[model samples]
Target: MTTLRTLTACFLTFLLSLAAAVAGKPNIILVMSDDQGWGDVAFREHPVLKTPHLDKMAAESLVLEQAYASAPVCSPSRASILTGRTPNRSTCYRHGHSMHPKEETLPQILKKYGYATGHFGKWHLGTLYKNSPVNPTAAGYDEWISAPNFFDIDPTLSNKGVATQYKGDSSEITMRLALDFIKRQSAAKQPFFTTVWYGSPHDPHKALDRDKVGYEKLGQHKANFLGEITELDRTVGELRAALRELGIEKETIVWFCSDNGGLKNLGVTGGRAHKGTVYEGGLRVPSIIEWPGKVKAGISKLPTNGSDMLPTVLELAGIEHQPKHPLDGVSIAKTVLGQEKAQPHPLGFWHYDVAGIGCWGEREMQALLKLQQAGQEVTDPKQLRSSGKPVKVSTKANSYPGHSAWLDYPWKLHRIESKKGKVSWELYNLALDPMESKNLTSEKKAEFEALKQAHLNWLQSVQTSMKGADYE
Candidate 1:
């Protein structure tokens, strides 16, 4: 006969076991390359760039052919991916702007569920100095080894806000740091979320000696650029192999993408506008999602962008929260899991680089490096920011505009607001003219008008959020 005490003990044990199961969610690894264009991959027909690992991963995963970045710049796109909202919603107006302190981030959300979250490599969303209010830790990462912007060989990084020097290929160094964090978390039986942002293939591209040799046919600059991508691809292979060797391949969610489009002068943007433009070349990127346990090998052309990352990850982890702020992105968990065929909503892209923000991230990082070289502790928070006061955006005069687009598959509408406040619209049937060679505005007046109205409504919503309405 079972005693009453034994029955109570059994019930408690069952409850504890259930809690562990809930906390042991899939490990998430998000890897993004710097300035790697859609055509910069071997599988995508890059004449010189070699990406064997990425090609293999693409074959085994669900590839997104229509993947886009929220913005055509690095900082804004990174903010959108982390917050599941457009960069404007968080006031990340341009390349140097820091992430808003008030906004919730992906790492913070995962932390609520007992996940060990770490950010490694380029953290252009904000300054990575020890005391910056917008540092990775302030943005919800438990621990971070990061740089304020794009870095290269022999780069200086902040290891949990401490300036440290590392020597290696930048891509490989970033991955190794992330892998260390993953190994520690796995050994402790804790699920983890890590972002590995590689600072390769960006400007000042300096590929290692071994990586640049094969690209001799191209010019020196092109060779170096393509070589950096080749190095990045090798690093990808290393990360995947490490995960499999650790026996967590099936239980991990790995995603690979580029922050934005390729360089305009490279002639490698797949026949579209390059980075910083709202055209296909500037926005479109190579993306692959691999979850051996849940998602099958396939391909998707449904339009998606960086803003969808956080929501999709949250849903995948089964964490439910009703956000007070309206989300610009919708979760595509069902699509990834093979339960849905198409994304249910169209994506919006806007680019308005607000000037005169006076971002001090570069200055702060340089100072930190100097202090480190002098063997001084980088503990002064004031040194990490542009101003001594916490960074804040003025909510006045929200009517600023630049280029905005409404992308709804088969059709796209672009609204360009000139500096003089003159507005012009262009319409393109993407299916018929993927190159956007012909404007359909005069022929498809009805469709153009409808998309124009839709874009206007979206602009109003975005501006409202920008004016601090979202927090309320």
Candidate 2:
């Protein structure tokens, strides 16, 4: 009788522990690379620019082949990921725009559910020292070590609000800070939400001498650029190893992706155009999600976008509250878990008003540079106006009359209104031609018209969001 009682007690204890483990929420680690391209990874078959670590990550994780950034620029894409909304909806239509304090960020929402949040690397959303209500901490991160923009080697990062200098490669430094935070969180047995956004391979490209040594024979510029990416990959490996060392590998969900497209001048190892355009080579980036025990290891050609990350993380963490504003992205948890046969969201949208050399036009870039140089910050839309009305800016697209695209199902309809007011449409069956080389617009007139209307509707919705109407 005594033996039976002891056996029963042991069985009950094991069951309870199993239940507790199942009930425990997983930690989230969102790793974003600056100006990385979809073709950067070796697994993606880039002719050059080897990314062994990223390739390994893709092989051991869920790789989303058709993932896109929220915008062609950095800040807007980051905002969309943080807020679970489109760039326009979040009032982050362009680069250097800070996220509003009222917006609920992924870290903030997770914090409410007892997750300790840390943001390391680029925090281009707002100034580090400024008493702005729209700062990263105000947006819901408990601990923040960030740069105002894409930082170079040995960049100075603001810890909380105080500036501190960091040595070595930028990406490695960022990872070190994140690792320290992770160690602390792990020791405390607290779940953590960490964003390790590396400022690497962005322009004025600089890499450590040792890192560049391997590719020294190549052109100085090309060597430095590729070196930064290679170093960034090593940092990722370190972070993964650290997680395993802490015995949290199985309990942590690590998501790796890029902020925008790769740089073309730096040798477009990714696709076509580099950062700053709406082309597939510019907006589409590599994305991998790794969650041991939960997410199965494999490649998912499913299309995922930046806006989808927030919702996906929230759902994975079992958080219930959805933002009052509608989301452009849906939870990709099902796809990550290998439970879904297709992507959660059908269409990924990319829109930008500013036009110039890169994604924005030269005139727009000059204006922005002037403002930054003068230290005259433009935080609010009202501040953009000289008078009472909002400042109106035109783009090359505007000169072309109007340009719009609707990526519906497997078809992408591109409507180009020429300067002569001639409306020309082009259609490409993306399912068959991912490169969008073939134009079937004339043959698919009815389909093109339907998609044009859909694109217009989407534009109207985006416009309303930009005006902050949706938030109200």
Candidate 3:
């Protein structure tokens, strides 16, 4: 009788602990748009575009007014989001570089805690076919419908490992796939992490006819570009509405942002130069997080970045496992909850001057699909979108080439290294000069010297990481 009583109590305790853990795990959905800028959304005073749904989110959620992408490009920023580290640490030096399989990914860690994870839309990290190391599945996502790069309308996406055709607007198609995953997970009462990476507002601005409704007056190019953004807004509304209808609105956390800053004329960067530069115009992006239960609605100018996503989500989910490698992003959970003002440390960004592997969307996918259906195999390494042979990354302590920047709050320092070995420095107090008009290196000698030394130390650490010291 005593043994029976003990067993009963133990079982009850187990059940209660399980329930508590489940309650703490929120349904996390990270939605990213490719190449959309800080001023692309309607709420940011965009003159022509109308993003009602996103505006609603901005009004009701925690808006990070000064959020930046880890890099000024797509794949590198995605790497930061996946691993909570900078791009080069994960071997993503350029736009189409593959994320290293050795790195610990967010989906992999979340899955250990029984979360159903799915990645949908533009997965520019690597090939979608099973062979690539950083393919969505290999990167730890349980389910994925992704593209090699930026897919467009009626995109031919890789379903699991098979290339398949998906119709409708690009952004909507991506959102619908995520919604399906959310519904299934909700039905099973399982926590989920779904990434709805929209492939719109990137290039070749192909917007649906209906979405082009109010933008006809703006030339054809502008109309199409704005329409793509409008389409994105509608999809955002759809995702939020679906969650509410499913009775899980308060239990979900939806984070929305763009991959990089805007283009020259088509979009607004909200800063100096457009995409590809280390300037605010290239790195600044629209970012918002909506969590009705824990995080209250408010505006915060706390500087955040893509590297912060993984650690932040882990903190929110109460997962305490540390990454086996160095992480550039620290948990900004307090910031999201309006308890913290800024990051604990400065953020680092580098535009590594390496060539990116080119992978087209429809053209390459359609060809791969035909090859797969014909029972043929892709044997060539170039055809497979990877070198196949092992390539060693350079890890010299003094080889910090290209443009790199360090943001330590109101002060930002830029290091420009020319191909001819000429090195120059530019310092700007972003709080005073958002456009980086004046060079304050001469005036702020103390700050300039400190930041330069800090950047050098960081660069050396990054070289160590590149040498596979982190994996060791």
| Range of the 10 consecutive residues with the lowest summed lDDT in candidate 1 | 387-396
Q: Give the TM-score of candidate 3.
A: 0.94
Candidate number with greatest lDDT: 3
Per-residue lDDT over 1-472 for candidate 2, one digit per residue giving the tens place of the 0 to 100 score: 9999999999999877745543588999999998887776667775566677787888888888778887777888898999888776666656776665567788878876778899998877755543456667777888988877777766666677555667777888899999999999999988889999988777777888777766777888988888888899889889888989999999999999999887776545333356776556667888889988888887777767788899888888777775877788788877788776774345545455443222222233244446555866555543222122222333223232344466665787766665466776678887777767788978888887788778767766766666656657
Q: Which stretches of candidate 1 lie over 4 Å from their true place?
A: 1-18, 21-24, 356-366, 372-383, 386-400
Q: Candidate 1 residues 1-472, lDDT tens each?
A: 5698899999999878756755658999999999988888998887767889999999999998889999998888999999999998888877877777788888888887778889999888766766677888888899899987888887878888777778888899999999999999889888999999999788788888899888888788888888899999999999999999999998899999999988977736744689989999999998999998688998988889999988998898888877657889888889999997785578899898456243343355667778777988556555466452323544335344788899988898988877767778889988889888898999999998888888888888888888777777
Clash totals for all candidate models: 0, 6, 0
Note the residue pairs that clash in candidate 3.
Answer: none
TM, every model: 0.92, 0.83, 0.94
Which candidate model has the greater lDDT, 2 or 3?
A: 3
Evaluate residue 418 in candidate 2 and report its C-alpha lDDT on the 0 to 100 scale. 52
What TM-score quantifies how close candidate 1 is to the native fold? 0.92
User: What C-alpha lDDT values do all the predictions have?
Assistant: 0.84, 0.74, 0.87
Q: Model 3, range 1-472, lDDT digits (tens) per residue?
A: 9999999999999878766777658989999999899999889888878999999999999998999999999999998999999988888888878888788999999887878899999998877776766688888899999988887788899888788898898898998999999999999999999889988898888898999998998888989888999998999999999999999988899999998998987789969998988999999999999998788888888888999999999988788886789888988998887776665469899887667777787887898799999987566666554553223555555878789999998999999987765789999999999999899999999999999999988888887887778877
Off by over 4 Å in 2: 1-23, 267-272, 355-404, 415-424
